[model samples]
Target: MHLPPPSEHTMVRTERVARRVFSRLNLALLLTGALAGCGGPMEPAPSALEPEGAQDVQAQALTYPSGSSQTVVSRRVVFRNGSGAYQAAAGFEHFRAAGAFDIALHNIRIAEVDAPATREALVLMSAGQKISSSGHSSGVTGQASNWDASCDSVSCPNVSLDGRSLAMKLRALGLFPSGKTYLSVVNDANFDHLFDSDTKQRIVNGFSNWLQAQVRPETRAIYLAGSSRGGCLMMRMAQALRANTALDGIDIYVSSFDGVCRNSQGELGTFDSKINNPVRPWGTFYGAWATNLTAQFPRRDRLHIFHVVGGQEVAPATGIRAFSGYAGSTPPSTGTNLDWGWYKQTWVKWQHKEIGNPYTDPSASDQAQAVAETVDAHLTWLDARLP
Candidate 1:
């Protein structure tokens, strides 16, 4: 026989009891997880610094992409950090197990809009003159060997250095997430093959696109890095970025290695010497970053700027040389919190022969590799300063 329906008051009372019991069960589960060193997904892991902003969002596993996809993530990006409006793109690289560790762009090309997108970014600008190339194609994690940035084309603008090695190193250190950190390079697409106004504007425009396209509420941190001529570009880019409103809330980190830059007047003279191309000189569009930055940020610690060079990088020879003397008239480089130099710091040659073997080789030394490690450490320390 069917039981009589319960009274309304009795049913209400029963529901209240059920709610209390469920709450207790939830608490028990939470306690169990904590005991096992597993915080609930909603809770960020204990961190000395501010936790990642997008850590609570669920995402798909990082898989290889099939094509060139550099679609930008639509978001409200401003121009508080730099000159032009923020912009960026991405392409996916799905390297097979057999894929070499060379200059291949690797998985997650900015080109693949369909591939997974991450709020955290690792952007790398290559040296001047050299375009994109397949770098250090045949290598694996945990093993050290020779590495090279073999570009896709012989022509400079046609090639760009791959950032797989840099990304890999960051990932191993837990600063960048696996498959989430989107690495990129913003070249002066319209350079008359020289670092002039046209090239500077082009780079600024590309970055504006990148900044506006790739950011979302999920975005947490952005790390911008460059080597040699690229370092100079990164500096100018960062200077311009300071004016962009898009970078207002996001954390930004910019680093340079053996970089060369134009003086306050947009001149690339040799430590106040003659210029290579007297027609025009490309600069930060504002002033020398090493000097002007001190006025821009003031706090010094608030600005996340890094510079690493090799002692072998001598004067009047490379960008680092230019950078070293950039402040010959000034003192205590601006925003350069982790300034360092090494002996065996040959640049273009190092990229060709000492890709994976930086610190080990005598001529190449371990400068680049050591600098990378320093970047990771510096980033972690910076994180600690955040809210």
Candidate 2:
């Protein structure tokens, strides 16, 4: 969610949270760079072998019957790198049985953009350089292994060592061999440094970049979903697709978890006023990020957007506020709510912010259920619109 220039009160609160999150993040990045420079000093990689009685949850591989025309295909479609655009092999599996086709599973890479700027920020941060704005860094963290999960479960989950996890739970049941399903897993901070390159490029590109790649002639119906930054990317991509008219015949269904949105009013706010202050670091970070993403799609009315936020989650609370308070007219005023009305008329659908974190909080089971229900509703709409 993007915010305009903050009010005095809002700026003060935002500065505090921004400092805290950015400080720790900057330190972590510096430490990582230091260890890399030390070569042979860092610890060895962890063994995949599990300890005794570790509740072995084997990574289940996609299964297919032999001698059948039905085939499961998997690939990672790569786009931009620091040097230029390139296609990477995405791990995808196509399943066909009884004359039916379905995308059993696939992994998409979210590579970092503008590597030079990222490197400069890292160097300055490591050398104790202080900047007015918090340098760009991955928001969520966890091990890469966390993201390497089996698709058998409804919640097909993935995570990086830094604690950032992408957990998508699709509600559709009874898989058909001929039916098609699109599952997109976005790695927000999947970084790979090639030969001492300064910038760390994310493995999975953001939604905007990804959509630009898929707008090719070969692309067909798409079921898109993302969490956090990915969610912001998804929303912007939908807008782009709609405006371009390139996706006119394509059927699309998009969803986000704890995702942020750009508000029309451009003021900093929280999703839940009662639970959160007017401004926080999350709001600022998303504000900045969403601004960058939305700026790419000038005409945002082209695609239908479905958004969901947890009332309890800090990010969505701010998002909710931005949505409700969006001012569509010039000389924006506090009482004017333009985006709210436009959202109701368009495909913008929002649910109550009840679900906390889909990955961490068990209490948010109900919220998770709501998300699944919403996806089902979207799919129903999509099926009717496409084919």
* Prediction-by-prediction clash tally: 81, 45
Tell me, by lDDT, which candidate is best. 1
User: Best candidate, TM-score-wise?
Assistant: 1
- By summed lDDT, the worst window of 10 consecutive residues in model 2 runs over 120-129
Predictions in order: lDDT:
0.36, 0.30
lDDT digits (tens) for residues 204-297 of candidate 1: 4554445445666766666665544555556666655656666666666665554555544443232333211111112311112233334434
> Residue 84 lDDT in model 1?
38
In TM-score terms, candidate 1 sits at: 0.46
Q: Judge candidate 1 at residue 150 and give its lDDT.
A: 21
Model 1 sits at a Cα RMSD from the real structure of 17.5
Query: How far out, in Å, is residue 7 in model 1?
Result: 42
- In order, what is each prediction's RMSD in angstroms? 17.5, 23.1
Q: TM-scores of the models, in the given order?
A: 0.46, 0.37
Clashes of 2: 45
